[model samples]
Target: MTPETVIGFARSAIEITLLLSLPMLAVSLVVGVVLSVLQAATQIQEMTLTFVPKLVAMFIAIILAFPWLMDKMVGFTRDILLNLPKYIQ
Candidate 1:
């Protein structure tokens, strides 16, 4: 494949990765911030206090987003497959 095509593939890969991870990351970030604020307000400074909620939120986010994530990944895979001939040439 040409350099431009390679770069484009890499760029798309990164974008897909970001898209797939966005919901989970966002959930974790929001959870962390909210927990931090709560901890500050309540003055309960425990490390796991932050971790457990973030984990659960992230897990829930992933579960909720899983179908969309699968669709995106499948679409990307199809696109790559459909473009395989072009890359080969």
Candidate 2:
């Protein structure tokens, strides 16, 4: 209802988003760096060399982290729903 409340909600949403994406982002970053280093060492300058591995790693990360991600998302949704009346007031 208030600007401060809106800002708080926005901040919470952003934090949740970042938290949810962290696993995949981290995996992708690490995979990319490692692949880049390997490519450099092997002198295999293939532009698409990192794509499949990064994708697979990201997918695996998402799958492995799915339960935790879902739990966090559900908790956030529950909190928002529980506080909806206060927000409306």
Count the clashes in each prediction. 0, 0
lDDT of 2 by residue, 1-78 (tens): 999999999999999999998999999999999999999899998877989899899999989999999999999999
lDDT of 1 by residue, 1-89 (tens): 89999999999999999999899989988999999999999999999999988888988998899999999999999999999999999
How much does candidate 1 score in TM-score? 0.97
Query: What lDDT does each candidate get?
Result: 0.94, 0.96
**Candidate 1: where are CA atoms >4 Å away?**
none
Q: After superposition, how far is residue 8 of candidate 2 from its true place, in Å?
A: 0.4
Best-fitting candidate, scored by lDDT: 2
TM-score of each: 0.97, 0.97
